[model samples]
Target: KDPKACTILLRGASKEILAEVERNLQDAMQVCRNVLLDPYLLPGGGAVEMEVSHRLTERSRAMTGVEQWPYRAVAQALEVVPRTLIQNCGASAIRVLTSLRAKHTQEGNSSWGVNGET
Candidate 1:
């Protein structure tokens, strides 16, 4: 047998659109390639960041005074990941992030992230 070749056609109204779409497709393909090379999957939509933030916040509780502040600060800082994601999508960052934070307070919901699709 020979080999199989696959083709992908990108259609857009303008060259700029075509180029942008091509770049996006290339990025997606790169992610696929990377996952194939390294067989591990990470959640998208800032899930990991939210989880880290939740863990940091929880760990901060054990600290006394100054040490606790840093952990809380970093935890708040980590929220910026999903907050920025929401802002970029033209959504309400405060509202969505607050809701996500509330959800993360519950056990087993540490991975909750802002849904940009909403």
Candidate 2:
């Protein structure tokens, strides 16, 4: 195909991918809202934050199908939540990324670590 045609194809594909991501994010947000509103879900403030962070990570992973991007998305989302929530949770948004990175490194799947061979 022509170069212009290839570019257009790639753009279209990327748009589709992003649209799917948005849909998944919406579904995840709804689930998170439900869990947060449920009195039985998380009894304590710390538990609530931890659960939210964990859910965000899990949802991001489940939606993205890739390790890195999903983790990034989770971190970004967490950053947008209220600071009080993060403070009370005893975990920051970056902590989620760090944990994921550490897990990947331990599993020999990370490329940014010291060895740089995995």
Off by more than 4 A, model 2: 1-13, 40-118
Give the per-residue lDDT digits (tens) of candidate 1, residues 15-117.
Answer: 9999999999999999998989998854658888888898899999988988899999989998888989999889988888878878878887766776768
What value of lDDT does candidate 1 attain over all alpha carbons?
0.85
Worst 10 residues of 2 by lDDT: 109-118
Q: Per-residue lDDT tens digits of candidate 2, residues 1-118?
A: 5464322122235878977877777799799878789845323223333345555665566664465576656655653443444445565546644554444434333322121111
Error of 1 at 98 (Å): 1.0
Off by over 4 Å in 1: 1-44
CA RMSD per model (angstroms): 5.0, 21.0
lDDT of each: 0.85, 0.49
Candidate 2: residue 60 Cα off by (Å): 46
